[model samples]
Target chain A: MFIKLAALTMLPVALVGGVVANSSVMIVEVDADDVHIIVPVPLSLAQVAVAFAPDEAKYIQMDSEVGEYLPYLARFVDELRAIPADAMLVEVIDGSDHVRVFKEDDVMRVQVDEGHGTKVNVRIPLASLAAMVDAYDEEENMFRASRLVGALRAAPSGDLVHVIDGDEEVHIRMW
Target chain B: MNRKLLSLAIGAAMLLAVGATAQAQDAGWIHIRVMEDEGTSVNVNLPMSLISVAMELAQKHAFDGDMDFGDEFDGHVRFGGRHDVEIDDLRRMWAELRDAGDADYVQVQGDDETVNIYRREDTVFIEVDEDGDDKVRLQVPFSVVDVLLEGEDNELNLVGALTEMANTNNGEILQVNDGDTTVRIWIDANPQG
Candidate 1:
């Protein structure tokens, strides 16, 4: 049951968040209308549960042609890790709504603010993102489970994503 | 009589100098220079004879090193991947190209990129020109590449490549310019290169 919930919540924030190297717990919080939910998932323990899942759901299959581009992708990811702090990668503004994507210190951040209490925030550690890409295995054409765990393990405690839509809110944090 | 003797001495000295230069041409040194706009630079020179001796010693010790060496190309070679042309196929293609004499082996042109691969004299050249100030120029001697493939099946011979590189004459082997950084590799008799 915990594995199913963890896997369900894992996809969006798998590429984000971090804390101390020792911090391995992820907290997911969601509040909507009259319902409030909070779940603290231990990443190390959750991964072990994931493995017991049936074979078909175990791994995502990658295209065979991706084998040739693995090296280039790795090199490109390495370059991404070197992006300087406070660098602005993207920005868009329309009336009162503005979307800004930038790097701050060790993490890349995406923030969308559209007046009132409606806002979205995402923070992804560059190192952990690089680790996520490193998880890919060319021979097997799927990401390695250990490296995926490593990506989350390497992240420093931080908010992976936060969303506020009038009365509804969803936030994912890792520590 | 003194003037005639001096003229003979000068001629003999010139002949000896020419002979020494020809000898140096047979065994040259390889050099690499990398300079970046960020103010970092590197210069390296390797003695071909030293490499030859080291390779010989390694071979005696049964050291193959297991470096793939790209197996090389006269035909299609994907390079640095599992799908690259096999060793035997490379050798076969090389043999055919060697006999076919110097000619353009491949040319790829796109709006933002261009690559020219060809053979001239005893050298095969691979040149790439990409947008945003990226470029590469590489020339590997036919002999050196052939030596690299002389190993047994599914293996590339690093020692043989070193030996051939030692024998080859002085010339530029490779150069790359990307944005503000430039890298150059060449060969000459100078250990200070």
Candidate 2:
């Protein structure tokens, strides 16, 4: 019965920017039942290390040889992996590898795989997602999951969500 | 008493009296008319002495600092002052500001318009832009700047000076002259309440 309800309430977001599908490395997918996150390990790891550099000049110097800062990058990744899945709104899978999670009853199962990419997949219940969305105020301007839900509720069928950046626009369609 | 000596004394006294009258005329007052886009106009009669006082107050408070006195100062200047200001005291205060800073300027922003007055390098630059569409710019030369800076002591006509500056710079007296809003600044020779 819960599975059927989850299927009915599922929200699928399709990223339309060319960067998301091609050049951009980060991807996050959220639905009523689960959440999936993926990133290129080396590129993301290098970026994390560069943020710790002392100053702008040092950051520039470290950018050319990002691999030299692997020890610092490893520590940062370990800290993120240490966070408990149950304590978070969405469960996070394995610390170093392709992370996967599944929602069974009230508990969520998570797994991490050591591969070229960092992937996190977690299961989330529909009721819990609704509760999270309900916490946001209607008048707030910041883009949040609640705003998306509100838009979805108010919009008719086949409405489009447009994300504008400067002159560029990325459109997401909802059915 | 010698008749010739008495006549000479009277002539000298008459010449002194005429010189004093001429001096009083040179120290003239300023009249300002501000018209808004809403068809509402405000007329302000400011004695040259009052302008000096306001300038001194602005300097003392360091009006350039992070204080938002745009509306208050605008209202005070647009309307007449309640008290009289000493011309000499204002001049002294202005001298201090001039020596301390290279320039002084005032910026007034309304709902959809902005007016900027910049005094720099012995020249005053006024720019008014409304709705980010229409813009009026003027540069007041040193000669007029000197007259304004030395208020109440010079023979310069305040209205004539400003009109000439606008004409010379190819700028309009009205800052914003659009259908939605019109802002005009006029200097008059006669005082009006």
Candidate 3:
């Protein structure tokens, strides 16, 4: 009987459109230094590292199309081979040869060991990026930015933290 | 009827107060519109190396103004590629621009005579006059390094103007593989008319 009465009371409210729903959005200010890479909106952290890092990264090239080595070319290739293929986002080689990664508008493809064996391929939809953010050209050390990924990274020398808002809001020190 | 209306109003006020209190506990920020002013606009692309140096100089011995301590400094540090700038960073940039552009435009003979030949955008202006005199004037177009800082300090606006003048056509803009990800800046020079 109590259940019936509660249902009846709620029925009038429901019919009268009294139910209200509000969504809350959180704005977070992340410090740049902690970020390893900052790509346009659609690009992920892995994509950013692949896209922006110096041509001679610890295991990646700086250029998106033409791969070049500035300082640590050979050792970088050796480190790539050391990583297990399955454990990595981009596949690994025989720990001897060099690999090159390339991307199109929405698709990212990797040529492993210089296309000797099974080349790893991954494609990120352009829609996922919302809109392209900013690209860093290693040829020039300056930064260009937009609303997407504003700055590449904050100065690691400085004390800055990343703010994340979700189930539990917190500050992450990327450095 | 009047009493009922008053009670309803009081209830509404109480609910508003509760909602505001709850929001204070929530993790969020309110982005306030801070600047909406216009000045001379010049687009220049200059050598980043020289600008960086000059900015460092300006930071050390630049203009000093009194500002209310409690006011909030709010503005975007816009980047096109991988650049970063901070509050402290502006001082350094100001110093660098002054140092780099100082020699480029002026050659001083002791204290009395100086030549001012500066470039703005793709255009260069040359003026000859005595030191620190209004008789020296040059107007040119140049793209400045994008540093959009705003607050009571006005440091960002002042430094941005200097960077825009210093970086103009110095061959700093780099070529990108795809047009998709290049850095673009839209300085909010006040609101559009």
Candidate 4:
């Protein structure tokens, strides 16, 4: 009888800064001229949330089908890891935007400059990205997010992304 | 005789009330939340102890401690090639699976659909994914299965299963996401949330 009442209710979804200090956490902060927000989420909670996400959010689809490139993800990451840090993977200047993708130390970094105090920077450990990619479940056609959560526990801790756009600034860090 | 029966009813009710109050103070709660994108949402919070008290009352009055449900569900419980097995056989298989510990039992993959049945620790999970329109995840503890299968033929011990669930830790039991609508059932310690 109680289970039948499920159609009549909803849940509180937002989770912020509610985990142990030593646990792996992802912090997202947005500071604008008008508003400020910060959310610190544990990786375990992220995995649990994935279980509640729609299928579209679980799988990464390309032109032909979902996870079509899964088989080659490891190989691609491996090749990238083998490249020298001094090598420039991609550099483009279009209009006022300047983009650069390069290997630095053990991680790959991408920086985008839009001029006038607008800049976007992303740093990701190649190994950690590969670990996340390996979590894909071939049978389910989706990622087994729990595995990704487990992998994130050992990932290098630091700022993942930082962006400054005019009067707004956003930062994402994992630790 | 009427007076005696009335006194017994009052005593039982009072006993249940006291027990429920004591348990509710410490026991966990079961929470269910369902929502739809750009639509109304609902949240239901039920005390685990309250359900336990109700189940105790039900055991004394309705089920009478019976747990064996008949092995004739007359339904198809698909498990790869062993899709058409009997209920008793399925239980036997479950026992085997549980003994073997955590591992994938069945995996069915299609062009636009997939189903996975696996066991993790003391729980079993059945997950179904059909493109972007539908996704369902079912999680049940091993004890719930044992209690449910204890009933006599053709009957499931739903009461026992629920009783076992009341004892389960605050964790997720089931979740379903279909397009705009999402439903989740979990247990926690907060009675108000």
Best by TM-score: 1
Q: Per-residue lDDT of A42-65 in model 4, one digit per residue for the tens? A: 887777677788877655434433
lDDT of 2 by residue, A56-114 (tens): 42222223223323333333223223323332212222223333333333333343334
Report how far residue B41 has shifted in candidate 1, in Å.
40
Clashing pairs in 2: A94-A112, A97-A113, B37-B182
Error of 3 at A156 (Å): 36
Tens-place lDDT per residue, model 1, B13-132, is 322222222223255555556566665454544444434333333332322333322322111112233546677787788788889998999999999989899999988887877776
State TM-scores per candidate.
0.40, 0.22, 0.17, 0.38
Model 1 alpha-carbon drift over 4 Å, by segment = A1-23, A65-73, B1-193
The candidate, 2 or 4, that scores higher on lDDT is 4
Error of 2 at A22 (Å): 99
How many clashes (backbone N, Cα, C below 3 Å) per candidate?
Answer: 6, 3, 54, 16
Q: Give residue A174's lDDT in candidate 4 (0 to 100).
A: 87
Give the CAPRI class of candidate 3.
incorrect
lDDT of each: 0.62, 0.37, 0.31, 0.61
TM-score of 1: 0.40
Interface RMSD of each: 19.2, 31.8, 21.2, 25.7
Per-residue accuracy of model 4 over B1-193 as CA lDDT, tens digit each: 1232234334433323322333443565555565656544545554545444443334334433342212321211112233254556756776787789889988999998898999899888878777776666667788988876664433444534544554674455445666666665555576444
Query: What pairs collide in candidate 1?
Result: A18-A155, A18-A156, A18-A157, A19-A155, A19-A156, A19-A157
Candidate 1 residue-wise lDDT, A32-147, digit = tens: 99999999877766666568766555566678755555554454445445445665545545456667777788787899888667899999887787787788887789876756
Q: Which ten residues in a row have the lowest lDDT in candidate 1 chain B?
A: B69-78
- Model 1 has a DockQ score of 0.01
TM-score (chain B) of candidate 2: 0.34
Candidate 4 CAPRI grade: incorrect
lDDT by residue (B32-141, candidate 2, tens digit) is 23343444343333333334334334423544443222333321121123326544555576566566655556789899878898777766677767674455555556
